[model samples]
Target: MTRQTGAGAPGSPRVAGAPARLAARFSARLEKWLEAERTQLPLWLPVGGVAGVAAWFWLPAPAAWQGFLLLAAALALPGLVFGRGGRIGRAVALFALAAAIGCGLIWWKAARADGAALPHAVVAAFTARIDRVEPLPARASVRLTLHPLMVAPDPRGGAIALPGRIRLTVPLEDAVAGLAPGATLAARARLVPPPSAAVPGAYDYAAVAWFAGIGATGKALAPVRLIAPAPAGGPSLWLADARIALTAHILSELPPGEGGVAAALATGDMGAVTQDDNNAFRNSGLAHLLSVSGLHLTAAVGATMVLALRLLALWPRLALRAPLLLIAAGCGGVVGIAYTLLTGAEVPTVRSLVAALVVLAGIALGREAMTLRLVATGALVCVLFWPESVAGPSFQLSFAAILSIVALHELPWTRRMFEKREEGHVRRLLREVAALLLTGLVVEAALAPIAIFHFHRAGLYGAAANIVAIPLTTFVIMPAEALALLFDSVGLGAAFWWVTGRALALLLAIAHHVGSLPGAVTFVPTMSRLAFASIMAGGLWLALWRTRARLFGLLPVAIGLVMTLAAHPADIFVTGDGRHLAVRAPDGQVALLRQRTGDYMRDTLSELSGREGDEAIALDDLPGARCGPDSCAATLVRGDRIWHLLATRSPYRIDRPAMEQACAAADIVASDRRLPGWCRPRWLKADAALLAGTGGLAISLVRPAVVTVAAMQGQHPWALHAAARPAGAIHGSYRRFSQADEARHHSRNRWRD
Candidate 1:
């Protein structure tokens, strides 16, 4: 194996061509394996991530440690690649070492941040420094991370009033830190959730806090109290200034009327973006822009690089590649620092800076870093910095999408597709447009299943909106934004800010219009983990697999088909008795008698055929044929038998003997009764299951099957099926829910409402 050495001597082996030699060392099989790894690596990451999610699903918290381990193995792929020892093996060896250290650090932070059992609220004389500011619409809130100097639980053991935060915004921070790099403040605020319960097995606030280095949360009890004005107010405050700046600048520039959305997209101040704006961004498939991701960083640096290269090329004396490379690296650092300051240095922003640094370093060294290595390095760094982020959506989805892009784009055909095109400014511009659109599409499509399973909604039209707006923003808006920053820094905001805002407004208008276009997005109410597996796997194969074989392309398609088939359709066919909702099963059987009806909320579900719609007649009515859990029930009308029931103001009259027989042989029981302190057989909650074990609404909803039920006597017979898992110490914690009373019951953190 030829080693890449730095020393130059005739006797010394040539080290300059190590990269080429390394590439050549591969056998056809090794080459294929590497290519496959590139393709499969991304696909596997999400698959592994989902698997971790599934393993801990239904449990109270995310298994951050286990999740980190799985991710570590994935990052150590190069070592997994080089099973044998040789000079080339060392490259993979170092990669694995980095991966290990990164994972180890994350594991430690996760444990420290895991204040899962800490009191939610506390009244104490605590001082929480504003770590960063999240941009929001009407007002802005500073993210106050506490040092946990004191912890006093409330006597009530219910609510804890810890501290408060000030409404620090972009302009506000500039006003506060006008002349200093690091400023200081003390505040008392209430830190709580954003008006909804976070999805289980997806994003855990507690886990998120660990990575963010937060122990407790609350909104500011009053305005912030100024503590000091040192450079860092101490080393602690100094550490936070860079992160806060990036988000602050973008917020400062946006028209105050737009709410937090303008700043959110411009920078990574998600706190500033309102929920509605978040929804809009999600629907528009432009949410990535708000995250301060590799895309944004790359765009910033690339623009600077191109300009630097162009300028440097014009200089006859400095035509050597090394100088251009050095200049690019320097420019990248400048832009990244400016960006971080502007966007408010967030975890994502810091990670992105690392990625930008890699790009810069590659240029400075005059060596093209393999895109995968850079991705791996960024990932390793993220792990080292915020290990708990392994369980965060930002970390999981961002890394997954980036790796997918690297993997898919690296496909020879995927690359050749562009290479084959003609060279020219117009051609290049068109290619850029295509690349941006494709990039958005790939990420959206890849993340769609997870988004649906965790939240809900597909944003069907987002791809088109992105395709239209992305090119305009990348070429027109970003450049203007950078130029505006320079002018503003040079005391030209009066001119630059106006020009920049106008250009930004134009881009925003394009996005809004494109997003407003018909069929821009569709909301899918529900989905399952299996569907996530299928979507990403399918997307990877479709983008990466090199085969003329038609069947290969169809593998992922087939997997999706199977998953969709298994998931009951979104439309709920509620039965009179809650235990038996008509769900279109995957086996093509219309078992119109099942109780799990919440599948209606799952946006990803699709009925196999006429199972739900065609047969639905009434609640208390039975059809021509008698069909029960074991046999058929009496008809609601004069007809033979129908799958329908009747709602009554109170308990309804029923043939005691017949009902008793049905109950005796009944495989499930359901009721809408709110009465607690009673136990019943396989209970149901208004046509939904109420059991401690299997076949609950969530499980049944994910895998809808036709279940035949017996009868319902009491009015609102569905109430009779309300089954509470044999009450015990853990009963309240694992209680199942139904849609009927969902609006009324508010679930708090860790347990049901």
Candidate 2:
């Protein structure tokens, strides 16, 4: 056949027309979508706020110069766009502005966190004033925030000025003169740097500590002696004193555990509640009650409004002349502010207060309070002020639950159902029960993915638990607590507290009973980030859009669920400290190489593996494992391949005999000591230096003969401080091993006796 030429070529016309046609179609669609999206600009504002927070978190901590440049660019771009550009341009500018604000806030926060931390553990004498004191629940220890006046190397050494604050966990026995805010004390303390994350993408303790202005975490080495007592009757000490007094009064009125719960609900001090009680509430799906969040705040404010209105009714002159609803909303606002302050103004509490105030403002303006626009506005305010909270579980979960509930309630069908009137008491009661059930289901569904992502567990009976728990908390426990606070101002609190305690005891019993049910808790394996993102996107789409197009959001949800189901656990896990190693055996149970240390990391591994409890298993529990005084070894068999892991605690000098034995018996060796020269070229080894730099390690056995390794500290902000190996080191090592294995025809006898 003759070759094609010119315009008559076989595929020329088709190929040439395709680009033109595709460009025309794409341009048309883009224009149409932009026009529609422009009308929903208010809805997109919260999205822009979220984007800003995400941009801040995704980027590495910027240098001071880079931060300034970012701020300049951010400011200049918005100004230029707003001045010269059209609607689309203005929207773009707004998004950029919001993102810039987030970046700037994080940068400023990071700069403030540059205080000196003790690199190694050291016992030093320190004189400091307590800034705040929080008691640990059911523990004899109390956490104190201290501002250092002077830190001495020893009794003879010169004073050292320490910047930022220190968190001291002092045992009650060591608090000889009693501890309170503004009390100056001198004591010996063992101080160290804040801990880093134990596993990748887990809680960042160091980052939280940095943001909270805590430079170091330490324990008091001796009894703390009061150098100066707190001043008498000052506004600065009033809130703290009141909180302490309230907590003590409640405890005095009720039994230990029950009183602790009451105090936590009323004053936001959870120190008295035992760990068992906390776990019971958490597992029972009623944990929200313990935290003074939106639910509690709304309940308190509503009760205050009711009480205010009833009292207003006694003075019929004012009730007839004024708009009672507006007056009630104003009263609620004042009460909400007081409650917020009384609860220490935590991030969640503040966010809830903002939402409540927005509602009151809406009532005063003769507009609906539960609109999406108002919710978005509240969220925007929170993100602007406390951008760091965007990364926290409380912010994410609370917002998710509230947004979902509001969105569901605003649905046409739901609204219509509420609009229908029922006359009889039985009918009204039934309607109320149905509404509660639906609300519980919607909230649970919306927050389930976030719960699983952060905690790796979901409350299976949460909806049922909430059904029984919500009414009791809302009507009995919260109202009684508020009443107790009121009566306590007049020295009649003991009677009210006694009543509140009885109600709390009943609530706790319900939580315990519900939490004890079989399958109340369901463990979920770690979901991939991509899967989580998809689920969140789908949820947002469903919640924000008010059209049938929202049905398409289910597509991403399905895809995410499929991805989650196919995900598998890593084959091996090692701790950041190089103290413990866990390998998946043939039967899929994790085998431990060391028993005592890295309990936290071990528990994390267990949870990720879908194991029931976080308890550590003994080395001898594994098949073909041996432990010595200074070393331990284990063999994990998967299919036909046997993988060896060895851990030793000796110093960095090479032990020739041990090296030979390890190399002869294992495919990989993990040790504190450096490997001998001959062994380095033969086996895959992770030494103390590598572990210290990488933070932790996870390995996947792609096949019986091929293994892949990933580092936990891969390019994270915390990892940047450590001395890093070249980016390609892990892949290069794997490649070299793969090449060798292929050359030897996958022989098991590559290392001979």
Candidate 3:
């Protein structure tokens, strides 16, 4: 027996196998939660994601409680679905299909909702703190969310209410720049629905106001005064002040560049790092070092747990579950919440914080985190906490990144990476590099869809910059920032600030150098809604479906690729006197337009649009152009069609006879305004159906008609503008559908879009 046992131990390896087997069994048990979660958790993820958006669809026009209602519904779906089954595969499938249904239903419901065109308007006196004022040559835009106390609606509307729109602009750009978020001032202004005439079928002023929670809109119509003693107060205010103070303290000790960068990494203030330094950081893939995101949060948590556990170890009775785990979790929450508030409550920060809390809660409850319920719980908390974020980038991208990381963590790869024990730090260094690169790729790929749709530009070198910067920041820079800031308050911050400033300088230099390279960023223009949806769908399919189905995911990708290649705007406008045509592109819309032109617009369109090119034609070069002080126009001939371009509205109307001649011969007409006699004008953004030689003139509105005149019925000639009374003229169109035609097409019945 001894011989046999010795032989088994030496050859069969059963002696070592016992411990290995136990570890394997434990891991498998956790993974096999497929069966355990079969009932509800898995089903909820897809259901919940859909419910999230659907709830958005269900929001009331004027959006009263819509956010809360929809978010609740979405939050509830995951739990309902997850508990229905014990099959992992079945749960996943259920959720996947649920996701599809949710997406389609959301689109349909939103398309069919009650508020489309807003008939109501508000006039208010508002006071707000100036957050940031961005300046350009001609226009200076101010972003100020309203303060409740100062806003009061006129007697024409109900007394001033919640959701008043803030005054976004004031005349003076320079003075406002110095004003911080806590500053307050007041303005009396008229708030009305955004006219449908300017942009048909797009967001109306009222609907936009609702989503933004702005009750009224304002421009400085009266003199502004700074009310002294009006300062930031309350938890939100205190947190913000603390963040600023923290940043200031941190920069006091570090060397200049190093200090600045260290401060940014710690406090999310990238203001001091110059553009060149930023570029170098990017090329080196250290950009994440600048933002306090998942990595930052996780590192903080890890550090906290380690330190806390060591403290707890000193007390034997305290080492067990309840007290120890409870304290641990609370500490984690503190780190997450404090960091979130300090970072201005950015969407990503909230998302990560919620996610961290979910896992922590699971530990407190003595359960596993991999369960679908936690995911659902986290999502619901976020929506309930801040519905506005549901419509933004941070929540979406942060969750996706977290999900991807979770997926990889559930796989064999993570296990392998963590298995090795090393005598020195070389292998650890390699592991860190690998982890950073993998994380970068996953996050960038996951967010590419939303980023393209929303921001338009991709940080192609974001990964490279992160690799170098993250470590420098976590180990050396962040400490320097804290040290600098602490000393700076005592009139000693300069030395610390200088010290950290140098490190930042190095990283910034790297980022700038890399950013300057030929292909640092592959510029692409913002695409159509269809294009954005298709791209997102493609990405989703690639990410979610089984490996075998991934190839099929490329179908949408291909469509998006083709669309991106062929994409171009239908109309171009120029000022009559040969000045640049200022067609508005959101933050990054001018990418394609930029490719045709050179360095146009102020501030590179704010990194939102990635498309830029050099095919623009000079305003003067176009023939048959004339100019007036307010507007400019150039007559452009596309093929055989003669198109007269006009900009800057003139008080005088066009000559009736010439207008008649122009309308008669014109194959297609596009304008910023409706000309007289153009009544019952069928409108669309991209195309006009009025083909030459078919009927006298045809107009094809690419989208469904927002406003339509059943028959002229001999209304006033100014009725041309009358028909343009906005779609669902008496209601909020974007918030909900108000199809007048359906309402009146057949009397004695209710109507829905």
Best by lDDT: 2
Per-residue C-alpha lDDT of model 2 across residues 137-218, encoded as one tens digit per residue? 4788888999988877655565444657889999987876557889999988888777666545455577677677777888
lDDT of 3 by residue, 1-753 (tens): 445556355655787687899987875674465444334444256434544453343332324334444444464466456645434334544454454444444444434433322234555566655443222112333334545455565567666553433434555542332345556665565554333212211122333344443444446655556654336477766665676666555545455456456656676666555454554554444554666777677766656766687898788776754477678777877877877777776666667777777788887788875444565567666655554455555566666666665554544567677556764798787887787788767766766666655445466766666667567666555556557656756777667666577766666666677676776765454355577667666765554433444567789988986897675432332211122233322222321111233343322332322343232333344445444433344444333333333432334666565444444333223333434554221112111221100101111112222222211111211112233342233122112212542233234221111
lDDT of 2: 0.72
TM-score of 1: 0.61
Candidate 2, position 40, lDDT: 51
Q: Rate the local accuracy (lDDT) of all candidates.
A: 0.48, 0.72, 0.49
Q: Pick the candidate with the highest TM-score.
A: 2
Runs off by more than 4 Å, candidate 1: 1-109, 114-116, 120-130, 133-143, 148-203, 220-254, 257-262, 265-267, 270-276, 310-322, 383-387, 420-443, 489-491, 534-557, 569-753
Model 1 agreement with the true structure over 200-224: per-residue lDDT tens digits: 1212343344334344455555555
Ranking by TM-score: 2, 3, 1
